[model samples]
Target: MVDADQTFVIVGGGLAGAKAAEALRAEGFTGRVILICDERDHPYARPALSKGYLLGKEERESVFVHEPAWYARNDIELHLGQTVVAIDRAAKSVRYGDDGTVVHYDKLLLATGAEPRRLDIPGTGLAGVHHLRRLAHAERLKGMLTALGRDNGHLVIAGAGWIGLEVAAAAREYGAEVTVVEPAESPLHGVLGPELGNVYAELHREHGVRFHFGARLTEIVGQDGMVLAARTDDGEEHPAHDVLAAIGAAPRTSLAEAAGLEIADRAHGGGIAVDERLRTSDPDIHAAGDVASFPHALFGTRLRVEHWANALNGGPAAARAMLGKEVLYDRVPYFFSDQYDVGMEYSGWAPPGSYDQVVLRGDAGKRQFIAFWLKEGRVLAGMNVNVWDVTGPIQDLIRRGTPVDTEALADPRVPLGELAGRD
Candidate 1:
């Protein structure tokens, strides 16, 4: 049980940290909750930055998880824009970045999210080359979008993952001519596999987005200290006014490692290792969100998820665990993305080669379908593309671990709810 007098410190001010703070208060713990964030603003929905926020469809205030006033009303202390340099586990304190504002905590939660992976190529440090990970990045990209639209600037993207594709959609919406170069044969080839990825490639092609597949970015050429073009290994130079690197993100785990916490290896996605209850090596310390490599109960494998849903749910679980509660953290992994006219929601993990076949209901070409990845007739994961209101049923199917009839799943006449007995 918590002492009800000691302070609870949460690092990383993203959704996970915010939710953890909320969970502590909601659980009737009268202890002090201090949320330390590197970002200047309060917690906000990061996924919106790629879509509504980036497109100017949502106001800046609407992006926040809770307004600045809400934190004070809830008696939660906000330490905004404080960069944490180190964690002294023995001292039960955190050292601030260079400025030296040290804070103490009885129980610590590391939610120190991830950082965008940088390209090793030359000229990447040029003025117009950028990577998106925070609100600052979005704001810069938004400003660039405005400039690009007015000047008809060319935007070159170095990846075709969710980030790259979403940015491409938003940039195109802003009237920037976009070109995406990927080392893979199609967009999201690593995630959705080649067949489904091809469908996305077709979607992008229809929207006047050009893709250079099987091309490796060799250099970011610049002139006058600003980006000019992206040169690939195939001896082709694609002209660009700006370049966005959407390769991937690396989990921020230096502090955890420094504090002697167990960390997973690179092959395991290299994150702070946590048990089923989200507890780290130290009994008094816990970790969640993007930095946590947790043993997923459902999949029976250690995995670290960077998606919003993981942070949203994992935060509360970690907080409860800290308070001596039963914490399983067995949520079926879920994530959604919007690109052009296609909207998709996927539940459960479909690790590479785990699913033998992909079964589809409706039409992939029409951008209306529910794709199911099956392992020996047991549904491993399901994705709904341009289809709405079926996430509950899809998640339930995964939790039940029941073998499904492929014929029924492929039949649109059959209701999705009937397929999942749990939901």
Candidate 2:
């Protein structure tokens, strides 16, 4: 049990770690809170990196979770630009980088989030190639995009995931040619499935973006340490003033592994294994955010979510659990993305191929719709794309596990809340 004299150590400086600390203080714990962050910047919203911030539509200062003064005022020791090299479980302490300063903890929370998966292709180390994860990367990419815009240059994105697509939209907004290469038939096919993925594919196409589907990136061609072009398996050469590798993200779990926490073995769900309350195998250690995989009562399987909402909600839940308070953490996973004029919000788990079919309430042609994933006439998950003010009803349906009439669900005239019996 946490007491006033104990020290609480949080290993990540992202939204999750920051929220956990805030929750502790709000709960009147009065314990020592030490937050260790590898980034030089203060805790900030990472979602903005591929959105408004990357497009220069938002200021760098605006993305921070707290102003520098907020930390000092709250009496939270904020360690910036310092890496936690190792966690000594027996010693109940964590070692820092190089200097090896050890910080002992009564309770430890590992919120180390995920990182972008890198490609092993040739020329990947060339200049002008980038990955979007940190503020530093975003600053460099912004400058590159600006230069490309002036030269009317082109960008070859290596993947068609959310980050890649968002960056493509931003690059195009700057008036640069964007070509997206994907091995799948459509962008986001793995997440939203082909029908909805086609919607995004056509949206990009209509905005003058090029696509090379079912192709493999052979090499990134460069000269004088600068990227000039990229070649795919189809032997097609695409201009590449800059390249973004947003293939996917892998959970940062090295510390969890080294500290003897139970690691998940799933192919796509590898991370530290935690219970429903976010407690790890070690009683004194807790894991949350992208680095932790916990069993979802709704999904009936271990799930590791990498999105803003999971980190936002899970942080406080983990904090409560750390304090020996009751925490089930049953909140349905939710996330949103902005690409071009399309704003999409998705809730709940559809678990690839688990849903029988997708029912649409609006027009995909018009880029305004609500797509519901149904399993045996029951709504399992739902997504609203460019459709306003209905997430509450959509999420309620999935949460309550209530069956609905397909005919009424596909009709836009019927209020979503009425169908969920909220009316």
Candidate 3:
């Protein structure tokens, strides 16, 4: 049992770590809580970095998870701008910052999160090459976008994933010319497949966002340390004042790997491996959020989700597990995106080849539709674009894992909750 003398250390100042600290206190744990973050800013949600904040629609303070005074009021030690250099598992302590200060923990939670995959090509170090991952990156990009918009500059973005697409939308809204280059055949091809991916392509195209499919960005052409254009393997050079590398993110697992903690393989979305209860190989240590790869009972697969919802929910779940409570962290994989005028919420894991058929409901042309990925008639994942209030029912169907009539599933009249047998 955890006592007042025991200290719980949480590494990472993202949503997962912040929520875990909040959970620990809410769970009646009187132990000392220390949250260590490498970033100088307080724990903040990242979705706004590409959406509202990037668009200048939301205030800077709105992104923080808690007020500055909340941490002190709750007696939670906040270590900002401090990086944990090493984890001495044998000593149940972590060495952090340049001074190598040591903090002992009876229990530890690793929520180091993920970092944007950097471009390995030439000219990546140019002045106008950017990647959005942290608050600082967003702040810089936001100012750049405003300047780019005022100057009517062209922005070439690599990758058509969520981040890239969202940034593209924001750039277009800023009145900047945006071009997205993706190796895939369509936007979000890996997630929505060609059928629904086409919808996003059309949506963005209508908003003056250009798409360059079936090519990978090979180099960022620059002059005098400033980006000039982006060159793809297709032998095409797209003029660009700025280039945003939104290829993807890799889980930050170096600390865990160096500490000899079990790491998940690339096939399982590589990260620190954890069980259903979020415990790592070492019983005293737990991992959560974008840094944790855990078994999903519902999907019958190991998953490492890097979405906002995962971090929001995973932290508390890991905290409960750390408190010795029975925790089966089987939440459906979820993520949402706001691009142009289309807002979407996706639930469950249904990567390409995992689902055989995609059933669509409502109208795709109108950008109001629900696309369901099914395997042998069983719902594996669902995404609602410009649709509302059906996430719970969609997740329920995925959890049921039972075959459903595709016709009923596609029928807008047939309630999703009825198909899931929730009623």
Best by lDDT: 3
In model 3, the Cα lDDT at residue 283 comes to: 98
Name model 1 segments beyond 4 Å from true: none
Candidate 3, pairs of clashing residues: none
RMSD of 3: 0.7
Highest TM-score: give the candidate number: 3
Ranking by lDDT: 3, 1, 2
The C-alpha RMSD of each candidate to the native structure, in angstroms, is 1.2, 1.1, 0.7
Evaluate model 1: give its TM-score.
0.98
Angstrom error of the Cα, residue 118, model 1: value is 0.2
Better of 1 and 3 by TM-score: 3
Model 2 stretches with alpha carbons more than 4 Å out: none
Summarize candidate 1's per-residue lDDT along 1-423 as a digit string, tens digits.
687688999999999999999999999889889899998888987998898899999898888888789899999989998888888988999888557989899999999999999999999889999899999999999999999988999999999999999999998888899999999888988678876899889888888899999997999998889989999999999999999999999999989988899998886788999999999999889999999999876777888999999999999999999899999988888899988778999888886577898899999889999999888888888999989999998888888786889999899998888888743
Worst 10 residues of 3 by lDDT: 189-198
Per-residue lDDT of 169 in model 2: 93
In lDDT terms, how accurate is model 1? Answer: 0.90
Output the better candidate (1/3) by lDDT.
Answer: 3
Candidate 3, overall lDDT?
A: 0.94
